[model samples]
Target: MNQHPAARLTWYAVLLVLALVFSFPLYWMAVNSLQPLFTGMTWFPVRPTLENFRLAFTLQPYWTFFRNSCILALISVGIPIFTSFFSAFAFARLKAKLKGVLFMVILSTMMIPPTVTQIPQLVLFKQYGLLGTYWPWIIGGLGGSPFIIFLYRQFFMNVPKELDEAARIDGCSTFAIIWRIYMPISIPVVATAAIMSFNTSWGGDYLAPFMFLQERQYPLSTQLMQVGYILPSSPNVDLFQVKQAALLIFVLPILIVFLFGQRFLISGIMTGAIKS
Candidate 1:
């Protein structure tokens, strides 16, 4: 497994370049967000100010949008962890007819583009009278994520079966085994799924919330569009700086989540890959 010192140095250099390239947009946004209104494009701000952020809040109910986003993210995080863990446990531990077939059917859903189902889902939610509320997003999360279930099942499958057997011998029920044994050891996958769900609900989604929720109920992702262009009170405001400030605030949570949970996310993903 030994490599030349020069090879290692070259690999490191390539990675550093790629990292900077990938992060450039974020760097640009942060730099622009601090710049004063009407400031032209510059690599670095000549004189930074918080006026853009102030305008972003003044033009929109920034805190309300943030609250909505947090509510959705929390719901998205909790529901999937509850549903996917148990669903994955059943697939991983139990014996059932058509088990493999059922699991594959669930996994197949992942391949279907969300756009294909949006119209039908929209109609369904509208019929249920959930269109203007958070219920649409909440109900959507009730159906546990296929990817997370697969990840959990893979990680569970890798666990020694002897643990389950021993637990059963001690009068542990199926639920008890899952709760007491597997759940404790599944922290990495749990954190991974939670953060993924949070990110998707918090920022990765725009169309669904925009379509389903009321204007006041719109989360930051969808509201950002409104903030960017439709400054009702300040039609003459510098929109570029306002948008940059809004975007920076919007993206900060996702950035922080990734920075902290990336280790668990990688571990969870790799653990699943080892077996399947």
Candidate 2:
């Protein structure tokens, strides 16, 4: 069943258009970040400079925010991945009577909107005297997240029970079985959860760290908002270029993560699609 040349050409055209549509914003950001401030708005930058990037770091503690964001993302993703791996393995392999019910309760949490819990969470953190600290974000991640657990459980379910039985017969404890057998096979799903968790904690703008931390302790996203978007302009400041440069910095880490882990990310996504 060979396709006609005209039909293939049309499909290629459609894909090319979609690619351009998705890529234009990123392209524009890169271009504008290099442009001179207060210049006329254009699709392409006329004259470019690195001054905006220089000014961005000079105006604020950009490296501090970057390090803080990396720490937060690492903690947030690392906690969920290891915890969810074990929880998912237990739920998928160990046939306990209450397993179904417990899994249902976990799934139920996903139905509730996070916004509804924000005030209560804020008060709870405040009561614990953990406000203006990293504790809130760290604690949230340390608890195995409902969504990541679900993802891992689904993937684990697709694994053959025979492997678990074999490992058990070989005198492997539950943790050993999970570590020596399932974990190796579960790399795709783990990568998926890691990428998702990292992005969620890295890019999230509300609650968690935001409500718990003050100005100096703010995450990269919040700091970007404050210094890049909300701050009042001084008479001598070139606000436009500064803001553009800040936006560029904000997106850089995410782009790097995606570029580096794209293969693993794709494998993770496809692993879930496999049927038992």
Candidate 3:
């Protein structure tokens, strides 16, 4: 079953090349953020400074943007995860006449582009006087993500039905079964949902915040796009360089989450895939 040594070497060589290609932008960003402002691009900087980091905060209300981002991310991730867990459990464990049909309908929603709904949603929010508040984002997440529910349902269905029967015989309530048994074993799935949701909420949906919220309420994702970082003392500094610095900080949390939870994310997906 083993491949020839030359073939294995070639495969690894290809992977190494691809890895470098994919990672080069991150490397370039780091290099650019530290390099002297307005200098020509180089593989490495000769006189890097921490001044860009300082400028990133001073030029704007970066901390306020950061706090807003965190608040929205938490709301965006939490409500859906909580709601999805139970909804997934119903699809996975309960028997109903139209369960499959219902699940398919929910799955179909995933194919609907968010862009198609934006105008209608914006009007709805405005009619409700929800614009300029966090309610637009909050209400959007209450339905939970179909994809996360699908992930949870797949993982839940893979568990033997006998376990549920056993718990029932021991007088475990339905809620108890989920809390004491399913949740403990589904750590990987939880981590997977969390990382996915966090990324989407934290940086993915700029249009929602931009359209619905005030300028002061903008998150890091939206605020980073503002074109007023030029300092009077250092008007020569490239705006792109300042953004690079802010972007590095902007991306750091997502990077850290994935780096640590990638193992769980892979495990959750693979486990779900094995059964369905």
User: Which residues of candidate 2, in runs, are more than 4 Å off?
Assistant: 1-8, 229-238
Give the Å error, residue 258, model 1.
1.1
In terms of lDDT, the poorest run of 10 residues in model 2 is: 229-238
Best by lDDT: 3
Model 2: per-residue lDDT, tens digit, 14-99? 99999999989888888888888777445787888998888788778888888878878888888878887778878877878989
TM-scores, one per candidate:
0.95, 0.91, 0.94
Among all candidates shown, the one with the greatest TM-score: 1
RMSD of each: 1.7, 2.3, 2.0
Q: Give the TM-score of candidate 1.
A: 0.95
Error of 1 at 142 (Å): 2.1
User: Tens-digit lDDT track for model 3 on 136-208?
Assistant: 7777778889999999999998999999999999999999999999999999999999999999888797888
How well does candidate 3 score on lDDT at residue 125? 89
Q: Relative to the unseen true structure, what is the C-alpha lDDT of residue 259 in candidate 3, on a scale of 0 to 100?
A: 98
TM-score of 2: 0.91
